[model samples]
Target: MEIVQIFGFALVTLVFAVTLRQQKPEMALIVSLVAGAVIFLLMLRKIGAVVNVFNDLAARANVNLVYLGVVLKIVGIAYIADFGAQICRDAGEGALGAKIEFAAKILILVLAVPVVLAVLDTLMRIIE
Candidate 1:
């Protein structure tokens, strides 16, 4: 059912893209972006389900909830950043998309710094 919904959205977007190409090119780009956003929204429920599973697994493994939350946030950031960059590229703004990607990378690194430091601290303690 989910696959069908995704395919239907893709088909509609393809047709819209083709139709807008001859009339208003800018509209075509907007349609494509909106379509992508709609598809993402449709998949949100599945994403939630996956997150629930991850939570259960983390609990079973006695993992820190903070770590799991941070990892999930990082994944969300990556997904959104990729979506935005792809839309920018589709609109012929490749340079802007590249900048967005670079920003996303920097943000990810910033977010992971505490985790990295903690790991290093643990290693140093073991050495000591």
Candidate 2:
């Protein structure tokens, strides 16, 4: 079912791109972006499933929930950032897209700082 949805989106995107190429180039870009977004929406369920699996594994392993949450947040940031960047690129704002990517990276690093500090504390305790 998921594969079918993905294939359908790809086919539609290809046809749209080819058809719009000569008539309206701007519409082609919009079609491509909408196609990508449609595919992403379809895959969102899969991402949720994977995250659920990770949550279960973390529970069994006694892993820190905060760490898992942070990781998920980072993943979300990356995904949204990429989505925004792609949209910007589609609009021919390549420089703005690059800046968006840089911002995402910085945000991810900031979000990871707490995890890093926790690890450092654990290491210090072990050394002591």
Candidate 3:
């Protein structure tokens, strides 16, 4: 039902965006971006539910909250970056989209450092 709603909304948005694209290309892009934002907003409740499930799982598994938090942050960044990059590409700015993706990758790496370091440290202790 939610997906059906999302699809219906997207279809309507696509129609409007296409219509606007003919008369005012800039306006078309704005409409597309705003539609995307609305869709993301609509999905927030689902996202929160997923996060709660992950939190519960992490607790049961005895996983550190910090690492779980970092992982969630990384996923959030990836999704947001992809969304932005797609918008840029839609606006005929492929180069800008690529730059956004590059920045996101660097940020993900930075956020992952602590997790990587912890794994390596655990491995070292096991070997010793």
Candidate 4:
């Protein structure tokens, strides 16, 4: 199964990283980054399937594609930010990682503003 394969790859990478960390720290970081990229690429297919499902459901519910796109963008930003932050942390830059996360939060809030306004407007109409 894919999960098993992923786990196996992760285990092997962990061991290799650990071994390299004792010798060449820079190369160890590089290996970690490459392994992370590989895993991310492997999961992209699954992510695509999920996006397709969301699109189908949105169509059935008559939801606007623009809103869906915005939501997806927010999610994408969150994931990418998290990945980057993790990488920074692994490279011993905790402060940088924290900054990345903070920026991501601000970006998510900005992206969500329109959706929040739409919901508030709908609620006001219902109460009127």
Which residue pairs of candidate 2 clash?
none
Candidate 1 wrong stretches, greater than 4 Å: none
lDDT, model 4: 0.95
- lDDT for 77 in candidate 3 is 96
Candidate 3 per-residue C-alpha lDDT over 17-110 given as tens digits, one digit per residue, 9 for 90 to 100: 9999999988998999999999999888998999999999999999999999999999999999999999899989999999999999999999
- Score candidate 3 by lDDT: 0.96
- Displacement of residue 113 (Cα, Å) in model 3 is 1.2
How do all the candidates rank in terms of TM-score, highest first?
4, 3, 1, 2
Runs off by more than 4 Å, candidate 4? none
lDDT of each: 0.90, 0.92, 0.96, 0.95
Q: Find the 10 residues in a row with the least total lDDT in model 4.
A: 42-51
What lDDT score goes with residue 43 in model 2?
Answer: 82
RMSD of each: 1.5, 1.8, 1.0, 0.9
Judging by TM-score against the true structure, name the best candidate: 4
**Candidate 2 wrongly placed segments (more than 4 Å):** 1-8
Residue 123 Cα positional deviation in candidate 3, in Å, after optimal superposition = 1.0
- lDDT score, candidate 1: 0.90
Give the alpha carbon lDDT tens digit for every residue of 1-128 in model 4.
98999999999999999999999999999999999999999988999999999999999999999899999999999999999999999999999999999999999999999999999999999999
